[model samples]
Target chain A: MTATLLEPTADPVAAVRRARRGPRRRYLAVLGGLIVLATAAFAVNVLLGDYTYTVPDFFRILFGEQLPVATYLLMESKLPRAVLGILVGLCFGIGGAVFQTTLRNPLASPDVVGVTWGASTAAVVAVITFGLRGTAVSLAAIGGAVAVALLIRSVGGNVGSHRIVLVGVAMTAALASFIEYLLSRASIWDVQVALQWLAGSLHASDWPTVRAVALSAAILLPLLAVLSRSLRVTQLGDDLATGLGARRFAPDGMLLIAVLLVAVAVAASGPIAFVAFMAGPTARALNGGRPTLLGAGLVGVVLVLSADFVGHYLIGDITVPVGVLTGACGAPFMLWLLARGTSSRSSS
Target chain B: MSVSTSARLVAADVTIGYGERVVVEALDLAVPDGAVTVIVGANACGKSTLLRGMARLLRPQSGAVLLDGVAVHTRSTRDVARTLGLLPQQPITPEGITVVDLVGRGRHPHQGLLGRWTSADERAVTDALVVTGTLDLADRAVDELSGGQRQRVWIAMALAQDTDLLLLDEPTTYLDVAHQVEMLDLLADLNRNRGTTIVMVLHELNLAARYADHLVAMKAGRVVAEGAPHTVVTEEIVRDVFGLDNRVITDPVSGTPLVLPAGRHHRPSLLAGKSPTPEYEGAEYL
Candidate 1:
């Protein structure tokens, strides 16, 4: 009988427990460590600014003790900025990983494929041409992302990841030209505002912006979590995934969720560059490449918060926004990754 | 951990293809339960397509593949997955995935919605590694492995599924001679010891003849000759199916058929090196 043929393993059933528990425990520990680091960075961003509000000041401000300059600076502006940064990072990190893992291409993230540029072009058009302001701009951005994503899908011809990247590259180029053309046509004051938004800043952080991102997260994160298990299996080649009972529709569904996440993220933070692209591979390395969405998200939070803090405080005189800093840091990293050419090498 | 079901699979009146190009048409075949069935054919001959259809990786345009008298496509895929496992040719191994983790993915069908990796999943993975002699490589990354080791690791993953029926497509394409034998031997052990019904597409005629309990030789999208390998593998069938002249000899060791293509040379004797035709010797020399 097959039962008799199953050799008695040298280690008792205990080996199985270790095999399952060991890497997961280590991954969770690393994720917890990253979270703690992000939280510490966030606290410093809130409390260690020029005015230097302490823990007591934060607590008192929370209790409605309006301590003039400290309350306005710390509780009102910095607090919302830091919270919004974390949510935006989570969206980028998880969304990027979802796209990369499902498509099985490291360069398939929304950033690489012009999804962010699509949103920016739409938002810029709304501001300059339509003369739109407030929530309409955000809606325009989301709509842009979805529309561009659909365009990429159509133009890329369902061939593979490389095709999507090529189409995305073309889209990014075309949109950049259009954005520049729009910028040249705008008034001086509008140009400054558009420039700042294009660079991706958290300068005008208020509860409403924070609340919008939070509400979106509240709805989307749980939906993503429910689908995450199926996402893991879909990472295997499609034939094997379907062979294991994953629905034939799983990849398309995951792609939709990824697009939605990207759209929400762009609407909130104006397409923070490379957070989505880098988060997946970074988290993959941190956990020894098993593909953990949570790990990617935590890394995203850390990257964004640290970049923001550095942008605000590290430089003197002129304040550089977080996206500029991330772009400055990320461009070199992307070049190095490109030079390494390992992304194309990770084949199925 | 317990799956007790009939490993009976049948493809009835099946017509399958990719878009407009038809691969196999009007084919009816039943897999012998608890036995090894090898489908052999020349290039682009639809052997792999048939295997894929039977494994439910492809749907027939006209007919259905039935498992235990119920249509496989109509049945719950989760249930079918638990009943059957497949190791695709050259499966993709994600970058930097550990051997143990890769094999544990086989437990996907057994997993719940949350996919809590159970102790049983672990045991199955470990048992599979041990069976395939890759237990020592459990911690190594798959990309770092040699091709043969990677193939064995993939087999371990399939074995971890612990299905009653397993289908493999060209499972030995990448292995060297010794390793190919070793891999076939391992499959044979699984068939003998566990009674797992295996359906595979193999290109090597000699190995197919030696190992298959049921050998199906295909030509132009139809089974040309099929039976026990000893009966089906012959000069006439080889010439008909493969468009080649061949002599079948008994493998001295296994007592199964061995195919040697009849070509420009044969065993030499005292007076044997001339062309057999009269037109080539007397008239042409004159």
Candidate 2:
């Protein structure tokens, strides 16, 4: 009976649907795998810290039976950092995917396009120069991101991806020098804080940071989801999008949402280096080269959590920042991608 | 391809441009209902700009484009999208999107935020795939298809829009000769069977003459000729539009006008009792 139903002549529509379902199912399954991997990584992140909690002890902390030392570590450092890692990962991943899709270039993520550094430069300078901390720094960073985006748009003149990337790279260089100059001029104590913040460390993360990011996510994620449909239409290029009845500035809202997410993530953590740059590409690979926001975000969660875990436990006594590890991993991959891109362009 | 009954898209005194430079100026043209209207011109003669204006891709710098006697620019774009479909010159295919899903995106105007992906959308996509003969390629990646197949897939996407009017801009840019003919034939079939009011910018004069019921000619952002294919595809009009001395002949197969450019070198070969293929003693490139 099932075989009869499966026959093409009996239901050609069903046959077409069934044939189409295979790749989509594979994409979903890859996304599911990334989710599972991220959840497992998140668990490992909470379980293995300075005072290592066994699986059973971890459950006890989760279930509200809090022993003194274990509970203190769990509540103060471990839980907040793990949660913040996942949150930051989601933001960077989704943000990167949005930028890449909007600009139609793999290298157009927030980090590569200088939006992440825009936030970082503002936050770092705010801490060093203005003596601002916490929410004020975050707000400044958000403003900086918007300002940088506007500046890039103004300078780049709404050109192709390659030209915009060149402008972004120049912007990033200018801002990086500004940051370095700020670090050089700061007093020794201010310099340490600025350096940590510039490296995009989760070391300063506490319950408040996690809560703040979570609250922002609660408001922003839904908004991004709502706007993502228009983003999808905009991905088919301006002419086609306009033809499809999308408003002329439809992608503007989505880009702003993505920048806001990046700002919030960068505020909670530091710039968190290549998590934004790497997430979209990794997710596309896993999803069979389809640039999905969810998949990219999931990939980012895995990358950040796993990088944090590896940095803390696997690398021994010296505690490296998540941003450092991501930078180390991302540099070679970015170079390889650039090389492959040039070869492909030449061939085409 | 819904039957176009009352859907009339026309540009009245419309001018279009990128920024300061005007591409099309004061173009007063009416797309005849339920027929294939092909706009032909030399490169950068504003055929594309005219199509863009008619499709509402470009807001006219002056005057207005009318859809069913309503100003197209003033109407809600989502509402207009339901009645008219456009396939641009070079559309982007998002990486790794399957043929079916890509075509299914055409149902965008029909969807609400929460009520997206309905059974109606499924039926529209399926019918589009069937009509374009892309059902077998439904599971295939759009980026991986051949040039001709990709063109069909794009047409299928436009068909899934289920609009009474469809506009296309240079739909046969990179296609080879046979595929170009096949593409034209498929569009002709859609025009004949569905009564879709099709308007397109085409570079090929012979193909345009053969397929277009209504042929419009443009030169330097202005219309030089507008009427039936025979009236529009004459030698004088060709010279006027393209600035080329050309001989226009009746197509052996379709009885439509075929343009043969009378260049300095080719004229001697035409006069001599010899094959037009230039003789070369050297070996062909391997």
Candidate 3:
């Protein structure tokens, strides 16, 4: 017997629109609130310290009305560090999120992808082998990161997430060993300088480093925002994304740009640990399940600023590196993740 | 909503295969518009490959697949997607993705860079969900659904594309017999109600005969027979195509041709062996 089922009547567009709107608004509100809180924390961090200044005194120092020697410390020394911490944190956090989501793997951070390794290796080589000084090492680091990225992509075949990660890890390991070998043969003074740099300390911050990072951020962040939709489609696998009319090359280009941004940040401030790994997932978890680029950037800002504050002021006589603090926190989390992955695989 | 658009798909002398090993060669076929066409063949006979080529998933080595007199490969992918949708066999679903979100992705071609989650896209997604009887499960994660439910959700995703031409590769795969019948009936209903042109590769001959308005039987990458089920299916044709001893009988309900094979286990009784049985009558021997 032949019978026809009548087409059902419903408003699909309204349903999907409703679905997307609720999450978008909630994420935006949460991000906005976090931004305000981070700014307040930063203010508190700047004003209250060993040589304390009132809020009014801090504003006076900020505008160029000089007060005492303590005012200069608050304005020049601590303020710049706080600002730089926020900026670099933003770069690492958002950059890490884009990398992980695009790859569809949570472990695919810029550090895991050899960007950090490339930058650190180049910086170390420039200092010890080539006798380079000042910001020259930063430039060398960027070049190294780009070269490693291109090399990994070439060797990994198709630009899928898994292949990229595998190639990146292999290249990073090789380069890291070479860096260690160089360090072993260097003089005591050279080794001390290299070790301190590798520990990722923001010991000396000036207007120049800030300007360079700001310039790079200004160029890269807008590019990432424009290509965000394409990245979302790319996360749905290649065949489906291509069928949906997105060019396969667009996501790859965006990913390369993200790598460049993170590389620049690492070159400026050394490979600060865990900021890249924690920023994206922390933001996403706080803002619900949607991919949160801007939110991650804000969370990165909070992470770096708080770590810098604690590093400088928490221990009385001893100064801990911001990277050290991040490592101290992040290493345990990594071990937990590894344990989870192993257990899941075993059960399966 | 009542838009009557018909596009004929033609494959001319198509040769398709992976590298170094040719599967189908110099094949010519025309898929009729606004009709349910079933392609039937044994395993590895290139039925799925032909469907893939027609959907432009695979590039033809020697020929072209044309849509309404124009080469399909020449048009932009989005333009082609607007008119056609292809549901591949056993696609993987991303983790924690709800049925509504998955189905909403089918409207990607219709959405512009700035035009996401529009009212029209939502309408198409809802319509697809309702048509496939998946509206109630729209909020549930796709991975959590049953096999039949998951299959219907995928069909909903394709339907949400709102294309006039639909191609399916073994849509009833990994389902129970009841679910297979239910899926075929759903496809037939869609063809009748929306005038959506459909072509599918099916392994079940009886189901294809019952549902398809036209059947194209392929053997060794060539069309061995093409006609209505009653005209094409016969005892000799079955033996030639499938290499089996079988008898063709009319289905009691649909009056369609049905094949019943004579297996080694089915033995003739002593009384039946002694008598001259009629053409349609057979002795029950177990």
Candidate 4:
């Protein structure tokens, strides 16, 4: 009786392959489309800024042939800014997706979990009280994010993922108050400098800042790729992940890498609001609700570039900071997610 | 009874716990290879904890869980996973993951970082789905499947791991009576056809008694009795393990020991005047 039940009726290998093809194709198509979209957004950000330049002239400037007005504007500002945007976006996207996946909560992005607030508070303190500039401020931001991450872990102390998020929220609130207190004590000129920390701005982008972000991505992304196989296993929760032979510390290791990615990106640019928070969900939505780390990273690039463009050009008069635009856009989406009640669909 | 020296998995004086709570204390048992072993006890008797300890989900604090004569915890997890598979109770289903993709993930220990999906991997996954009768639901998202279908799909995932030993924790918890029997039958088939060593925690006593080749009854983190179901599942053991007033009788259909709880309100009119342990001819009726 059991033999008859165990017998295979036909070739199921073909059925399994056929089942996989549709989703595989859809994933590829979504991934390819994101790459194309990111490229276009980068182009639009660089070539169509306030002082617009033609494609040939932009390339000529890139190739080191100086056209008087185009040279300083393109080389000094637009190129570095756009490049920095893409790099920061990649870091935030990949890092945030890892956080959300591992913690099994969409709201567990680094920004929402106090990493951004930590960076901003430290950056503001460096600029205002310490009179720090450029690389020193960036260092402060990186240190701040890492410090907050450590604080969260120590304070939460094996309380599990949901408790960690609650602890982080409390930390973010505390750090945010510290920032406000510091701002209240600052002079007008200091306030202008500190505004970048309060709301993320790409206005400070230079070759050095671009290099810092690039170098971080260069070292970190490959490491992340090496560690990502366990990421897939870890998403099934700890017990099952262990059952499936995932390394004992793999989730913690991935989270640490994610924290560093967000830190470096925040160090290069001020904590760009919601890029980390929004990218993963967007990528998942685009890929027929499947998680795609690469797709999320590309989506992050597109999001930052487009947000930067809109913040820089689309708004009238004063240039709104990239973080401010993202905040405004992200708040609505967050509310939508809340209204949708994600308990039924959330994946760990 | 002597646990044979050839037993592949053994827990010798193992203690398991979480934080300050000691759940299973200094327990010893050897799992018979290629047989279905069902563990049944009241809630919090530490039966599940013992199962977790054996599966290496919880590390033993005092002694070691041995697999193939070596400390299981000392072995590389991937190597252990290739030999033993586990289906955790309430395993998470990633949002929008298809049945095939979820099942394919059971192949994790088999593949390296750069390993591509080979025909062998495909065969394993297909065989799993086919054996579990989930091939028709291969393309459907896991969240969309019914409770029974989802349970089968999870079993398929474990089956896809292609391990010789499988451990399940309460695999039939949420299923109706029919699905529970269906699940047990499927596991029995795996044991018979694939010669897989099966160990599971079950809440239903009569079902466990009917299906298990070996039955273990635990009370307060200690194994009170273990042997062939008929020998181990007497009315005295049931009262001792579960603290329930019950009668043990032969199942009319399966010729296995069947437990009939003697609740206050359910006494039959015909049996009201009879001796409590009245003998029956060949079998007992419900």
Mind giving the per-residue lDDT tens digits that candidate 2 earns over A1-348? 011111234455895678668877988899889989999999889987667888888778888997988988897889999999999999999998888877778788889889988988888888899998778988888888888987886787652357777788899999999998998899998887677667877788898889988998889888888778876567677777877877666577777888888999988888888888888888887777677899989988999999988887789789888899998988897987688666533100
Candidate 3 lDDT, tens digit per residue, A1-348?
Answer: 123243432654555556555556777798888899789768867776677888787778788887768767876787877777877888888888888777766677888778778888888888899888788888988888788877877886665548888988898799889988999999888887677557666677667888898899999988888777675555566655655656657767777887888887887777778788888767765764456788888887888778777887897778888888987878776776567556532100
Rank by DockQ, highest first: 4, 2, 1, 3
Which residue pairs collide, candidate 4? A235-A348
TM-score (0 to 1) for chain A, all models?
Answer: 0.93, 0.92, 0.90, 0.94
Q: Count the backbone clashes (under 3 Å) in each candidate.
A: 0, 1, 5, 1
lDDT digits (tens) for residues A9-70 of candidate 4: 46677889999997899999999999999999999998896788788888788899978878
Where model 3 places Cα greater than 4 Å from the true spot, the runs are A1-22, A29-37, A48-53, A287-289, A335-348, B1-7, B218-248, B259-286
- Tens digit of per-residue lDDT, candidate 3, span B121-240: 877887887778877676776767888888888888888888888989899999999999989988988898898888999999889889887788888787888767776688887777
Give one digit per residue, the lDDT tens place, for model 1 in A75-164. 678899999888888988888988888777778888888888888888988888888877898899899988998899888865235788
Candidate number 1, chain A TM-score: 0.93
TM-score of 2: 0.92
RMSD of 4: 4.5
DockQ of 2: 0.42
Q: Chain B TM-score, candidate 3? A: 0.90
| Best model per TM-score | 4
Q: Residue-wise lDDT of candidate 1 within B132-233, one digit each (tens)?
A: 877767777788888888888888888988899999999999789988988888888898888889889999999998899888998777788777998889
The CA lDDT at A310 in model 3 is 85
| Per-residue lDDT of A264 in model 3 | 79
